[model samples]
Target: MDGSKVALVLATSAGGVGRHVRSVADGLRERGAKVVVLGPASADELFGFTESGARFVPVEIADRPHPLGDVRAVARIRRLTRDADVVHAHGLRAGGLAALARLRTAPAPLRLGPAAPPLVVTLHNASIAGGLTGAAYATLERVVARGAAEVLAVSPDLEERMRALGARSVGLALVPAPATPPSPDLAPSHEPESSQDARPSQGTAAPSRAAAVPPEDHAAAKRIRAELGAGDAPLILTVARLADQKGLPTLLDAAAGWARLDPPALVVIAGDGPLEAGLRDRIAEENLPVRLLGHRTDVPALLAAADVAVLPSIWEGQPLIVQEVLRAGRPLVATRVGGVPVMVGDAALLVPPGDAGELERAVRRVLEDRALADRLASAAVERASRLPTEDDAVDQLLSVYDRVMRTVF
Candidate 1:
């Protein structure tokens, strides 16, 4: 395929979706394609698009749907895509905007001649509740599906959901697990330290070279364990957003009874969201053995220090955290929802969603039964090996772009 100019659009600039878009943009750029990113203005500060060598165009798109915002977003996106060969939008809101921009309406005539650039949308979530808000989102989903040149789902379950939601051409592109570097490679390089020491100090405080250097996994893990008061005790780590869909409340309910075990477990939840205050309240009232470390950047270290990783989500579309757990080869206890079972297979102990008792039992078994834990960890390593890499995902995505562009042009 020729080097095409692609516009990668996203509504929000935080979380896994933002990271995925950045990786895709970087990958496309590496392959000689000109990548332009369009998202909320916050994206510039959040992801550092300029540092990554990608041109960023800040668009005013709200996280939630608004009539005026939608109109403005569509207009901005249309102008941005005029010179783009492909427009790839991430999430429902961005997809809807891209779709609206591409639609051949009387009021909004095609500015880029008869054919607009192919719009490829990646649907990240498959679960939505049934209500008026859900109904409105469903309408937008259908519009996005119909307007998009191709729809990509992150998991098999989500692929099916997209098809049912009116997406004609749907493809599955599993989100790759985080690649683990070698132990020696995980160590911080001394080059930055030497440079910092040699450089003359200015009157103003210089930026910390510590932030530039990667932390040693072993040291970081020990530090995290100490902070959590997990002294030789089993560390059950969960890295997820504190959202309703994550079923964090159910996990807390389960944790309340964990003190009954022979040697009580220590739970470290490393994420922040809207439900943080409520979770803190519930933990205080119940006196559960759980620590909420809001939005941690040391997930790899936490995983290394964990005895078991748990994900008690009500719904998921092949969660990246679950994949990270498996990739880290940590024994997993995740709820059997969406594409989680498909992801873990026999490598994780799957419990029913919202079943706090079952979640509790699963965690206890993984902690107590040494042989079972070992078996799961061993299986996890093998399963993770079989999973696709980010490079592979990028190749599959570029293939879709080529296929769509061929048809469109």
Candidate 2:
């Protein structure tokens, strides 16, 4: 792979995809592969691929569907892939653009040879949007599937979706969590001191983000917890982008029911999105005991400060936050969606998606039953042991690249 050139294309650099791309690029570089990244300009600011030793090229790729932007992105991708040995695209939009670019830039029929590069697309989400938007996305998925030489899904559920979308060569590759170590200062106090020692070491816990938290940031978390009146109260933490896909509405409804209990639990949601205004309105109208912290960087501290972590997403592809929570040794309550069940296994209390009553009951059970929460936490540490580290994920991905190159060229 020393002389091989791999181009990674991404649509948005704002969420988990951006992080994943950065990790892959770093891994490829470590393996002596030339790597180039093409994505929205914001990706540089968000993930800093250039600073991390990848050739970063900005392109006009929007997160949502746009005919004009897609055309521009595809044209740019074609130019970038001129010297690339492998064009690996992440997410649906980027995959579509890369596929179209490959088609437009293919060598003439008479000149076509085994040296032609392969296009590998990794589908991060299997969810289809509702109404007309869903139909449009479905159409794009079909185009991407038909064009890509290989389609990789982050979860088994998404692998099935890829196959259904006409992908002839489909594979599964679970997204790996970052390897930032948990902050020692932010470690939760409820777990026995021997908890970490009790678990068998599997070396699967991903390295966390930089462990050094500013003193002020730690203070801020403490102040926020205090403001929420979380004194001896079971604190529930949810870190997700506020969107329809996140199932915030359902979580709010469950919160409302939980609020009516004799001693309501305090909930803190740490992330912002387009649904912020509407979610705030609903929170005020319902008077739920939930706080929204927009886009936090100190999630490790927050996890250490919370009693339980919950993910109520309607759909997901191996959510990183879920893995983070488990790595922090916190009990989890997540909906059975996408690869969540596979990620959590028996470590979390799984509930049906969009079920407010069941969600509320699960949260309540965790809060009231100390023994149950302890059991889940213990299981969480062990479950986290099974997760692949960033290095492992990179190794698997490079193997895929090799396989695709072999099959195509």
Steric overlap count per candidate: 0, 7
In candidate 1, which residue pairs clash?
Answer: none
Compared with the true structure, the alpha-carbon lDDT of candidate 1 equals 0.78
lDDT of 1 by residue, 336-402 (tens): 8887888889999999999999999998887777677778888888888888778887899889988
- Model 2 segments beyond 4 Å from truth? 105-116, 181-224
Model 1, residue 155: distance off in Å is 2.2
User: Which stretch of 10 consecutive residues in model 2 shows the poorest summed lDDT?
Assistant: 204-213
Candidate 1 lDDT score at position 394: 84
Error of 2 at 312 (Å): 0.8
